[model samples]
Target: METREHSATAGPDVAPPVLTRIPARMDRLPWSRFHWLVVVALGITWIFDGLEVTLKGAISGVLQEPGTLHFTSAEIGSITSFYLAGAVSGSLIFGYLTDRLGRSLFFFVTLAVYLCGAFLTAFSWNLWSFILFRFITGMGIGGEYAAINSAIDELVPARLRGRIDLIVNGSYWIGAAIGAASTVILLDPAIFPVDVGWRVGFGVGAVLSLFILFLRRHVPESPRWLVIHGRSDEAERIVSGIEGQIEKETGATLEEPEETLAIHPRKSFGFGVIIRGMFTLYPKRSLLGLSLMVSQAFLYNAIFFTYALILTRFYHVPAGKTGLYLLPFALGNFCGPLVLGRFFDTIGRRQMIAGTYTVSALLLALTGYLFTVDLLTPFSQTALWTVIFFFASAAASSAYLTVSEIFPMETRALAIAFFYSLGTGAGGVVAPWLFGTLIGTGSRMAVFYGYLAAVVLMLAAAVIEIRIGVKAERISLEKVAEPLSAKK
Candidate 1:
């Protein structure tokens, strides 16, 4: 039997810690192993995601090559938009499929399809074909967010979920770092033609996909998913097998854990069931989606679209050096979640959300000021960018985890994809256009970013008002999902 720890911090009148019974053991080494797989998978996914981030518009020089396929700047921008469309569709379609068809299958298929798209995109004969293939690849990237996050929610123990989720999300920045590094390593202009740089970058994603697919073979389907689908027999077997490992490790005498399972557990799924369940089970998640979509679309696109200008005009940074120039910035982003995530469960979700947002906003504003004042040295510029990037990355990490945990299992995948799409599609897609248009006059870019920072701070303010906020309980999918839909 597992022993419980009492919280002396709780008032004498407060209730004791209540444990949510799960199908398998949460204490064994396997739990950590399970999370490792997710972390690795996320890292791999981000590598490809990172490649997209790097290769998207970087091909301007390559496209200028006489023998290479030609693309107008407008056509190139359309391709990026096309990629975002794929992401939006992937989030909704693959998200629903993950829940209905089972996580393992969707995971495999999505990875495969994404890989093929990347391969096709790399070898495209024309800009149109490249756009088509890029869209296909992006769908996989979009699907990955929902599929990976849902799997994490269902499989990880609640208490560790927040921290783990933060870690997983952080991998995307690691992808960015890798992307930047790869520019220097794989695409050195002296040794390799610029034409080969984009192709090499695309190839990296395809290779990474293969490795991730191979690693996923040993990963198990969520026990919670099985029980929900009414696969008691299979769920029991998985649970028992996990417990058997726990017995060998902890040597704690086991008692039958109390658990209630769904009846007529769904065996098969269809588009209709996924679509209906999405809204029915996740009414409130749309709010989160709106927030995330707005936040991501705004910040990411703004930074990406304007990076060259920011580095050159703001920091006196050279254009060619951009490849390795973002290291500090990426590092800050990479570290934010691991450092901040530890406190999310205990610190109160709203406070963390607000705090991180305020910090990020302030940092961005600081970067803008340095830019406007013409006071930027390369060293000082990089330092300021690093700190700001960290805050932004951490805040965004928390959002993804919160969204994943705050919906019912019935619509978990859809909720993840839906809101993510909104954030990335709406906020991300328009951010560049808005930033470019608004970034007129002196310090316009700074002021524009300042406005975005303010909006995030506003979101932080409103988070506390919502009753369904992040809680300290071991963040089980159950607590996050809410009983609103299941009660029906």
Candidate 2:
């Protein structure tokens, strides 16, 4: 448990180098209640995001009713864009803070922000007010993406990081399913007034966030983040406590970790370091991260945000009944990661990421053609989407996984935030608005053309993966990409 701090060979003015085994100690521990606690507490971020999004999509039609806000399809799309804009800004602000401050601090802060935004959304009086509140809610969830992914990846054992991350990211659909199911009752005219029902739907997310905030109080700060920030003593204490707790729970002694890393511990890393790491130190990885993130974000956001609209506009499905179609779609999205996650750790990242992206793209293209030709019934179209997203979900989740684990520790959170913001900004913020406009045109061919664009991006990303994807499966994060401050 000893951490040695000594002057670097370079000079006295330089930050002292800390030689520590915190990462190995964490990676070698047996899976226990502690890991599950981390999963449930931090993993729920995706669920909340899924709920927020699905609720919005499911109620798009309801909001257009005269009893509600009377939003047009184009306005609904713009609202989704506003949410993405908030998320992009939040990720940048909180991501820098998470890297500089600590992961544990921001977890509570971001969730609290989301709670407030969701609660306020229930009381919005007009379209502008609703859009503003949704933006605020997006900020919280966006911050959660940067902080929670960094924290979870740092805390989990290296051997299990891949599957665990995929499962956790995939759990977004659990919230999607919940949102879809609840809207069925919440939006039903017989059960609640149209305006009141949509308001209650948003309130549900606030209540869920409150419970998750309580659970997060039990989760600890990441030892890896602590050690890199010149808090080696605190990191040692936390790791030892984790080891002791796990041993006590299992009633068995733990083995010593053989690996140790030497890093120059600094109080904070400047943006210059992040800029260099991304541009100078790891340009290829930067390209890879962006490609994966942008492709998936474009495909998912464009489709999911506009899904209910397509159902109502094209297939003439009832607004209240959209949730039933979404239930199966959500299930397919969830099951893809749960089922295919292990392969990323076994078959390896390059093959699986490339394979899934390519397969999903091909499927989507086929489905788009079917829709354009007017061959799909609403049930058949939903069935096709359920199948397509089965692969697309896994591909999308892997994008997050790749970005989080492929950067230096000093910049991990910010790197995640940067790529997430850039990709989401480029792909996510525009997709919903663009697709909404297309759907508003009332042309299946126009919508099919949009799907074709998404397919092109996915194919290009798959090619990039085949060319340069990291062999990160089952590898320690340190080995995946060495820390910027590491001393050879």
Candidate 3:
């Protein structure tokens, strides 16, 4: 059977449908069925990924009604923090589990947990209830990085990995865009009540999980994992299936028939293995991981969570128009990789890492000045906001690309969770709180203080990378090698 996109939506939920048609090969790499399966799975996970954030972004709209979950700002922050904490825990735990167990079963586990959270979030009557639900959702989201990335990393050839990874990760923003836009599209006080709109938004996200579950049946575990785990029988079976699919759709012939080769199995899976596995991979990678996490957390939270709030709270823009204004920010996110990802391989991951973070930091700093001094009008502020976010998204995607690739196969998932929790989840949890609290304090100056600090920190990392590049950025994935080839 030919595989299609996991879900064809604006973000990861919606994939660019997979066809039975065989993709032409560049070099020896033929487009294979297994590869497509990995792509769709990641994309679907990402679609729900956006829904998680969009639901939170539209909280103000939901709470407008008198009886719906009346909660204080601090309380709201605490609840949101739980979601982030859950994601963090999920990522760390799942990363090791994927390495120890396999990607196959864990995918279902994550999705199932996420679905439970999504429904509970939609049905929750109070703020705390929503938080509890959202925490479950976060755990799924946390597992998302380790599980999806591990599956794709193992299956997709290194050459195409950079571009594919960027595309895969970039879909999250598209998810965010569609999710945020849905809030505006479904805005009807008469037909769709405010709280109901938010509920529907989450329900839409959760409903997507079901269709993806259907697609999951078509997905097999990574053949590489099979080979690593001493499951050559299953690996060969999967390889044969993929080859058969390729031959059917693309009319391509394999260079050789699938043959049994001695599979080199890793040591037994255990908690000690993950702990030792990470350090054995190179101690510096962990430091790079930490920096990436800190930079990514601040940059993402600053933009996605805060941008819509800026339009509504500061500029007095209507809720509907806020989505439109934020559209540029989302579009900026989608375009960043298309423009900069080409450099990940050529300039080498290190240089692109430095350049992206450096430029993003600079752009953000300028955004602060523009806002701080009141240089930009309401219109320009929004436009400038989008411009900065464009670079921020690029920086974030690039950061993850490097972070995901550097660790040893044994610790890859665990390392990703370790860094990602501090970086992405921390950002998601805090961005709203920091901005909301500081802004509410009647100090517009707080935006400058907060963002300026982020800029400086991000730039510092770029500078360090310039001096001595991290190994992950230097090791290019073989699959997307051509796409990231040096620009002339």
Candidate 4:
């Protein structure tokens, strides 16, 4: 029987809708090869992002040395800031396209865009060209965060969503770990010229994107998206194909989907509608998402972007040796989500998110105080960061998970983009510069002040989350938040 109806907004060009069990069909499936395909194809986006941003920091000192880019600490900070600005712009722009144009299109486009940016970065002749390339690369990654996060959340099984999302997001540090290890060799003056090693580092990310692009081809668009856009027939067909593939792979009888949602097919959403839905219809979710985004963005950008500078400026670590410190830090961040992700599913989102955020804050406060008093060596400092981010990374990753799952199906991509851009723009774009200035001042006390600010913001966010967080675990997307086009 036909399950969908036309909204007044769906135009004559829209096809007649049919009933689809796509959402239920998707959410009820067991883990299969198909899920692995999606994870590898879409999730590597974080790896590229981890690689890109980590390379920026990992090579900061290399760029400052003679016969390289000859950049100053401030210039490196500015370059990183430009990348964040590009990311902000990209998220807003591509985010809208993902919602309007469908997830399948933007996944390919964004990956290609990133490849172009990362490849060109290797050819940069000076700081200006380097910044321009970095900005372009950032735009690609920013777009990926919106489109890919929306797709992943929409498509993954409800029971597995929290852990999978956290793991995928945390996988950024896997890239960071790879970047750190590679830079240790790439930045070695004995093996390659100082100038050539850094350029090769940028090329590695572009090369990695080629593999992901191939894997993404077999992945399908969100059936949830197709049905709401008056394409329920297509949605049903895709889900059927998915079920067939999963059954063949697992050789187990698939359970029938019990839930079905009816949506009034929408042609498109206007800017005014999107804005209203985000701010008016879902006000608390909006605020919670913003707080999470901003706090994590502030702490991550302020510290990670300038970490090498801290090592070189304060502890006298060599430019090449900086990666050795970063490798352990990246592992700590990576392991956090892998270890703690399941708890977000089992223990509940509110308790886990709030607890992680609060604990990370306390750890940071202790770490900052120790640093201010000159009680930390380079080794101890990295150790503290490893422990601190063991919690902070999961909290930061949950920030992404929260924003993606809390809104209506129609607004998922744009909402992700909006929060990411706002939070990242407000916090991320300014953090590197702020920390750069503090590092420039050569004062441990000055940098500690920045740490204090991050702690306060994190605590405030934890309070907000505890009070108003969405307990979205093991719930279908439509149940968590109804489709905007649902019949009342």
Off by over 4 Å in 3: 1-28, 32-34, 256-267, 312-314, 318-321, 429-431, 441-445, 470-488
Q: TM per model?
A: 0.86, 0.95, 0.85, 0.94
Encode model 1's per-residue lDDT on 92-134: one tens digit a residue: 8898888777777877888988999998887988878998998
Against the hidden true structure, what lDDT does model 4 obtain?
0.88
> What stretches of model 2 exceed 4 Å from their correct place?
8-14, 70-75, 437-445
State residue 163's C-alpha deviation in candidate 1, in Å.
0.6
TM-score of 4: 0.94
lDDT by residue for model 2 (1-488), tens: 65556663734323677777788888888899999999999999999988988888778888888888898978987898889899998999999899889999999999999999999999988889999999999999999999999999999998889889999999999999998888768977899987899899889889988999999999999999888777888888888899999999999998987778888877777889777977798899999999999999899988887787899998889866777888999999999999999999999989999999999999999999999999999999999999999999999999999999999887888889999998888677778778988999999899989999999999999999999899999888999989877853
lDDT for every model? 0.67, 0.89, 0.68, 0.88
Estimate, for each residue in 339-420, the C-alpha lDDT of model 4 and write its tens digit: 9999999999999999999999999999999989999899999999999999999999999999999998888999999988
Please count the clashing residue pairs in each candidate, in the order shown.
14, 0, 20, 1
Measured over all alpha carbons after superposition, the RMSD of each candidate to the real structure, in angstroms, is: 7.2, 2.0, 9.3, 2.2
Q: What would you estimate as the lDDT of candidate 2?
A: 0.89
Clashing pairs in 2: none
lDDT of 3 by residue, 1-488 (tens): 12323432323222233222111221134657657777886667766786677657666645645756777756766776788888888898887787778888888888888988997888988766877898899898889788888677666655566766777777787787787677665666676866677778778778888778778878888765554454545666776777778788888776752322222244345667567556653566667767766876777776666765666666778865676776667787878876777667566777777877888888888878878786776689867766776666667776677667766555667777778877865576666668766666655688789887788779887876676565443232322221110111
Number of the candidate with higher lDDT, 1 or 3? 3
Of 1 and 3, the candidate ahead on TM-score is: 1
